[model samples]
Target: MGSPAMADGYINGVPVDCYCTDKQGQRIEVGETICLQVDGRMFMAQCQMSLNVPMWREVSPGCLSSGLTAPLQSVDPSIHTLGVDVEIFATKS
Candidate 1:
């Protein structure tokens, strides 16, 4: 499962929580997994972020890691305040 990250920010031309950060405190310039916990079920999203605007909403739709590339169920807005480790790339997972 991926870590919990905010969808409303940016790090190095990418969405803050949806991209990888390296030890040099730099954004890895690559896509990453954003995990979402909805109603006790964890879903994964494959993200590729560019700008920090509506793109955050676009690349964050979760899909299964394997079968069926379609998106998972929509996230319930009621479950807010997801606590995740915020780090720049290069930090060990």
Candidate 2:
């Protein structure tokens, strides 16, 4: 099985202590990008940390391809065109 997004490997000796959890309760390491489906639209989100808070910030308006079973024809218009900034917040443990 393929994942909806790919997790980036750590750079030489660089360590990441922050991470965000997805809707399914999966752990997303900082700097990792993931594809998420919201309301019928596909989006690309990156895990990031802000003020010690872990959050997923939308990096792309739409996802052209996701390894999931969902087809690509399902994405709606640009998320920016909707005048909304999508962000998912997760508590750090």
Candidate 3:
């Protein structure tokens, strides 16, 4: 697969750690970029796995959820495989 450029956006509330993995025995490389936006806050990270296997993982800090109050926007469906899960949180003010 071709590596996509880094995408920028925002994520609301406190950002929780995220992980991505390929469970279909495919080769995915690290350093590839996946852009994500949650609740308006944008996040950018390099791909962390580069081998054909069954899983890739990404872990982000909680600050990615800063300044979030609403729900996340609809994500584009062409950039990733199905069944991916995201988790987020907010700090008590």
Candidate 4:
């Protein structure tokens, strides 16, 4: 709705992406620091949407089948205790 995740108004800017998900595996708002962990290295970015919507449109068309794997953890500023665990990836295009 607002500016898209990337400057060009695209969500899948990188071959890989990260997300902060709730207990039900639903994505929440992008926090102050959304972190992704791949190969034990962490990458951080900002999320642009709220958790109220389903994220079907945000996904890249071929991303899932393109060797994408998620092992992520993101810091939700809304939570005072701990940062939420998220989806990370192994991606190639």
The best candidate by TM-score is: 2
Task: Pick the winner on TM-score between candidates 1 and 2.
Answer: 2
Model 1 stretches astray by more than 4 angstroms: 1-30, 54-93
Candidate 1 lDDT, 1-93, residue by residue in tens = 233234445454465444454335555434555554556655554344445432212234455565533333354435642433346334785
* lDDT for position 11 in model 4: 51
Flag the better candidate by lDDT, 2 or 4.
2
lDDT, residue 11, model 2? 28
* lDDT for model 2: 0.67
The whole-model lDDT of each prediction reads: 0.44, 0.67, 0.40, 0.41
lDDT of 2 by residue, 21-82 (tens): 88899888788898888889889999976655677889998876646555434555464334
Clash pairs, model 4 backbone: 69-89, 70-88, 71-88
Enumerate clash totals for all models, in the order shown.
6, 0, 19, 3
Write one digit per residue (lDDT tens) for candidate 3, span 22-52. 3353433554444444567555544552333
lDDT of 4 by residue, 1-93 (tens): 445444333354532244456436666554433344445654444444443332322322222234434532344446653443443333455
Best by lDDT: 2
* Per-prediction CA RMSD (Å): 19.6, 18.9, 20.5, 19.3
